[model samples]
Target: MFDDRASVATAAGMRLAQAGVRWDVVKVRRFLGLQAIEHIEQPGAVAVDPHSPEPMLYFFVPAGTLADWDVPDTRALNSTECTTHVVLPPGHREAPPGPYWLLPPSCGLTPTDTLHRALERALHRPDPHPHFRIDTAAMRADAAQLIGDAAELPESTVLPQLVQRLRGHLMVLVPHVEDRMRAFARTAETRLVAQVTVGEAQRRLNSVPGLTFISEIKHAQTLARSVEALCRHAEVPTHTVAKAPAPTVGVVQQ
Candidate 1:
């Protein structure tokens, strides 16, 4: 399983072999980081799994040869990913089109890489799935606010009582949330250990049933009601009834 760092290259290679492809791309920093380097040299040799994947920027240093491939970049990445690199594999002949770059531009050189060209295209790129475009960031923000409020319950409230109140309100929403989740589990007709971008995950998830915006909004509203009910449990306030309207003169006509 490529889930293990050590297995990623071999797993990637096997996947490529299955497809009869000889090359796959790698990110430069990652290629170097995996080598356990405390810091990367300006030009250093990097071992690459050519069988990686297209749309991947294969990174290799120009200063080194295959002989320098004594180490693998094993460092993990997070905040550093976007800042580090995107490069070309050493000794690789048929590099991808103009948008593709053997060397990522440094300093003030005019942008000639595929990434730059692709971003230029993106400005004009047509919407592939217009209807499914969603604001997941906003959705996540709302969820964070809900949980943040929930975490503020008074210490005096017993956990059991909290659970009892929340349960009835939870029943208001459909607990057997439908086909959207099922797709994630069953979409394995052909599987490979590969990197998938969040955009791709959303694109696939959008295809599932009960995943439309209106459906999501309804679900969110139901969840909000349940959470509000839990919060109200802490105060146990009484609901004041509005007085009935006085009978009007029309009663005489009746």
Candidate 2:
């Protein structure tokens, strides 16, 4: 019988510990795992396999616990079903190209209640599309940065390049958002249907870096056409401000 401190040494300079003998593991995706880490104060022995096809984090919990986990995108690994071995680092430090510790083992394991609540919040309390991993917060930050850049510098200086960068990021986001809106339109009320189309156009236009386009551009239709063209050719070569026309406003200047 293995004691709490006992571990079977392997030839690969790693150790294998039998699950349910000492502790159970809560396996989760890296994103959700990060979320869980954010929710908890001090987590225990969180191991991450960054090289895996889908990187996973393993959270050590009390043995014979959380086997029938109800949390989404998480798996509770215990020895209830079968014998399991947990690959542990040889020492108290991280080794790359293999499992490394995000949070090394402490005197305690992660509380299941805290972990479950964290996963629940991470799942339901974020943006509208909870299922999709659209980092809208990062996108909004980029948009804000673009606004600041446009305000600080002349349009001819470096504003064009800033706009292009923001535009590329927005292009990647637009299609995913459009598809979600369309799906909503089909099931939503008739009055809501037109709102989707209008909102879609407005959002695309509004996402065009500075607020000047919405305020000063007289030829809205032409600008809309340009934005649409960019959306359609998102995968193709990127068009500079000189090539992309900004109607009635010399924002591009070229």
Candidate 3:
């Protein structure tokens, strides 16, 4: 059966204990101040603070058997306040392994590299599912394309419509990209610790499922070229200014 909130919290506490990381209710209070993080109950899914507005973090515990629960892309939490996700590996008989913490941009790790490391450690799986990785790359490429398209749109009646379309595309793609990037960074870190070549590690990433989007590769190259052109334009000085010399400190003779 899927783990409940109390069960997940207990497991999370246990993991933290094993890692020698202390948890204090006081710390939660200190970080959140007077703002109350509300909890809501969702059937077949565990959710905490579901009702709160933007900048609110929600935690979910999967319902039904842990194996049956569809593991969501951990990257989705990157934009949310924070989301605690739990996933079970194959053949597990007991509760799913984690109440892994997911913090948003407001948390310490805002950059892609840092967030990726944290997720890898949290998931702790030897092999990430292939679909997850491929989808992630596709998402990144799609997001980049949408961003480019949005940039190219002329300020006109159709511009708002184009911008909205890009936003919708990003809403779907950004999370997957973030999640897979995290997993990749973590796995790469492990390989690094074992003194493996970075190239080999990347090769392993290439092996992951759904990575067959050759078009995305071409798109990324095009994007890079466009960025280079933009940079060159930016580098070209627009205007020249006259220089002024500093005044001497010594008194001038009359």
Candidate 4:
């Protein structure tokens, strides 16, 4: 029975592949043995027979593969079991349940919610530092030194627009930093999300050693709000951000 089920699943996967549907195979196996015989009456539980090498196989396939194919709504029969399947294209209804034994073409196994949750968890870790950290002062100093050194070099033919190129390089670095941060954040837990936000204060503080200043404070605020909303939806606590302290200047005494 198990071998037949495995064969059927393999055949189904091959059919999908031949039809130009890309997918990954995940296998689920059941065994019936002496112990299984003792508890064979349990519902939804399969018993494996130790003496018999063969067992039963049951599985599910992700719905995305059928997005392009015409799939009937009715359940289909496999060699050993009836299979319940649904087709869900990107941005369609919520994902269906599964130990989804099959992963369809163009449909990576990672679910959107699962990814979001993982990112959220990663971001909420006690450490706020991004995985990759850059010293802005050091970078700027290096850039200035490089440019100054280049200025002294005899014009080795036409210099590729130095300043413009340097500026572009910095622009590229900004996104790289953000990408690293996001990636680090995603690895936290299966529930975190992160968005970079730039604020006037953040902009002014860009020169600060480890601070990150992106586009606007509003964006970060919006992300925080979104996180809060998600927490509410999940019946989780909303995190609060602490306000910065006011700064004061001291006068020199004669």
Clashes of each: 13, 0, 5, 26
Q: After aligning candidate 1 to the native by TM-score, how far in Å is the CA of 163 from where it should be? A: 44
TM-score of each: 0.18, 0.49, 0.21, 0.18
RMSD of each: 23.8, 16.0, 20.7, 21.9
lDDT of all predictions: 0.26, 0.55, 0.27, 0.27
Better of 2 and 3 by lDDT: 2
Per TM-score, what order, best first? 2, 3, 1, 4
Candidate 4 lDDT: 0.27
Model 2 per-residue lDDT at 160: 40
Q: lDDT for model 2, please.
A: 0.55
Better of 2 and 3 by TM-score: 2
Best by lDDT: 2
Estimate, for each residue in 1-254, the C-alpha lDDT of model 3 and write its tens digit: 22222322233243111100111011111112111111111111111221224222222221111222222343232212332333312211111122212221112212223323433443443332224221233334433543555534243454333322222222222232333333332334332232222232223222222233444343333333333322222222222322223334662321
